[model samples]
Target: MEAKDDPAIIGDSEFTALLNAARQQDPEAMLQLIELFKADILRLSKVIYMPEEDVVSEIVLEFLEFVQQGKE
Candidate 1:
């Protein structure tokens, strides 16, 4: 079967496995993951913290640092 048809294709890709683990450890995963989740996170933050829009960038930067620290 082709990779597209193979259920195990993702498990065999180094990057995919790395990302899956990273996502579990870090809610934001990496940069692209941040982009993917940014909308949801921003909406949640608005509800809980009422943070300014500009604060989204700052919060994401801080979260990335925190996640990286835990990995090391």
Candidate 2:
């Protein structure tokens, strides 16, 4: 299923809050945000022929690092 079709994804307001919290380096929010999009990320990775485990790990780490950097 597409990301847009995923019922588990947060609504706009909650998404906005999550983004804000992530930018502030809230680890829990960052994790929640990642989990929220995990399926979509995996789907995209598969479409591009990337190994699921490696790609997902790389993406999640990169995202977390990016968010952490923004707070520095």
Candidate 3:
């Protein structure tokens, strides 16, 4: 995992705030959330034999859609 992804690097409350902010369409928060999960994303992508960039894009798109749905 990347240094930023390490749970110990951030407090639980802070992480929760980050997640909430991302759901609100805060770009920086979304990017931070992506950084936090990037290692797992890459690992999953490798298992499916797809390109890493494509997997990343797909996941981000799906996440954004999920957030949008929550607002409806």
Candidate 4:
């Protein structure tokens, strides 16, 4: 699908703002970022054969770690 046609696709500025807020540990912005990846995460969950909730948790944990690493 075209990027513009994808609801998960945010404009560059909005994404940067969101990422910044998320990195600062803003729960609302973090949730928004999670929502953006929900579809892809769910799809990954199907192939991984784990509980859906666990899959989501694992990915979110990894994403948060990556974001935290950027602060260093």
Candidate 5:
């Protein structure tokens, strides 16, 4: 496991494994994935939406809906 405040990590395989583990609901993996993508997701949410700003919760919910719908 990584330190709680390790700040940054760099490695494709490590990140890929982290993502895979997150899909399995490993808490640490989830946290890591969130930490990694939170900024990116927010940026994407902003770009995809209208002039109205998006809150964090809304961004997450929108992303969830998009992903869920895509899986169907």
Candidate 6:
């Protein structure tokens, strides 16, 4: 799939905004980020033959933790 046509491919500005919000510990923004990239994450997990639930959850958790760490 073309990157431009991919819903998982967010614009740079949107990504920056999401990163800022995540660093601020905004739950809604964090959820939005997860929802926005969920399809791509799941697809990747499947392509790698990983369990979707476990992989996705770990990814989300790690992402949140990483963002939170930026505040420290």
Q: What digit string (tens of lDDT, one per residue) describes model 6 on residues 1-72?
A: 556676667888988888898888788889988888777677777765667788888888987888778752
TM-score of each: 0.43, 0.66, 0.69, 0.82, 0.50, 0.66
| Per-residue C-alpha lDDT of model 2 across residues 8-31, encoded as one tens digit per residue | 766899987888899887889988
Worst 10 residues of 4 by lDDT: 63-72
Error in Å for residue 20 of model 3 = 1.4
Q: Which numbered prediction scores highest in TM-score against the true structure?
A: 4
Give the poorly placed runs of model 6, Cα more than 4 Å off. 3-9, 47-50, 70-72
Model 5 over residues 1-72: C-alpha lDDT tens digits?
A: 665765666588997687666566567876676677676666676666554355666766664444334421
Global lDDT of each candidate: 0.59, 0.79, 0.74, 0.85, 0.62, 0.79
> What is candidate 6's TM-score against the reference?
0.66
Candidate 3's displacement at residue 62, Å, is 1.9
Pick the winner on TM-score between candidates 1 and 4.
4
- Winner on lDDT between 3 and 6 is 6
Clashing pairs in 5: none
The candidate maximizing lDDT is: 4
Model 5 stretches astray by more than 4 angstroms: 1-9, 42-54, 61-72
Candidate structures ordered by lDDT, highest first: 4, 6, 2, 3, 5, 1
In model 2, which range of ten residues has the least summed lDDT? 1-10
What's the lDDT for residue 60 in model 1?
Answer: 76
Q: List the residue pairs that clash in candidate 1.
A: none
What residue pairs are clashing in model 3? none
Candidate 2: which stretches are off by over 4 Å? Answer: 1-7, 65-72
True-vs-predicted CA distance for residue 61, candidate 2, Å:
3.0
- Which pairs of residues clash in candidate 6, taking residues 3 or more apart in a chain or in different chains? none
